[model samples]
Target: MSQVFKGCCAAFLYGVLLATSLGGLPASAGEGGLYRKAGGIEAYIGFVPAEITQGHAATQADKPMHDGVPRGHHQYHLVAAVFESDSGARISDAMVTAQVSGLALSGPRKAMDPMTIAGTTTYGAYFELPGADLYTIVLTIKRAGATKPVTLKFTYDHRNP
Candidate 1:
């Protein structure tokens, strides 16, 4: 594709992702998911059962090796999508890390790997979120061009949500 076409296509996908993911919510006020805007970057945090990743691997054999679903503790798949708040451009190269704590216990601080989904790039990591407890997820995002990284927190109520 031409350079102009690729730029327009990327911009178009960014807009679509913003519209569908944010769903008109300006910041972190949504019931379906967590979306936070702070320090010039917008972030979304979510998690799914780890089995979903394994299921996909079994069904999709043609997927690229680089896009493999991350595997670790294999309990939950934590995902985060980050973007520049001003331009709505996806931050694919950012260094993303997360720490999950719940019930007075905390998991080891680890880096989240970058993954591409449906032509969009996001960060993900595997964690073991067991039981029906309220979990606090703290995310730290650092970009190469930025002098300081941004840190954000989100609460996930496994019992209620």
Candidate 2:
């Protein structure tokens, strides 16, 4: 206990055994929990209605739409999303874009392969609106430093569209 306090108590017990062996790892290694339940950059916009309207259900209320959308006075809104990051991490080469407005819709800003989520890299999209209400979605998600491409504006409500 004199060699410089035994080398400062062996470097404080080797930093508490390397922080308890990295806290026993496995919290998905890093950035865990599906990007804090889709409120992070991992992504989580939603939709999936094909029909219901006025009474609501044209996609955006419990994620309907695989058996009911596509009807009426023009109110499609069948968009879907669930993109999470850092699993296999490639997301079809990330350069995604979207800008949906309230509805009275058109097409294409994004529609990625029936909403992907295989293995783990998490990516999804299904945009197919023809009508609905309340929308200000604005996703970007590009790679290369990924500095300013995670903009979310969320406010979807196409009850029965």
In order, candidate lDDTs are 0.70, 0.42
Tens digits of per-residue lDDT for model 2, 39-112? 33444444433232212222334663233334554544333233444452323456656667665543356533
- Angstrom error at residue 38, model 1: 1.0
Clash count, candidate 1: 0
Highest lDDT among the candidates is held by which one?
1
- How many angstroms is residue 107 displaced in model 1 relative to the true structure, after the best TM-score fit? 2.1
On the 0 to 100 scale, the lDDT of residue 62 in model 2 is 64
Tens digits of lDDT, candidate 1, 15-45: 4553465333343344344777789888888
In terms of lDDT, the poorest run of 10 residues in model 2 is: 50-59
Q: Candidate 2: global Cα-lDDT?
A: 0.42
The parts of candidate 1 lying over 4 Å away from their true place are 1-33, 55-74
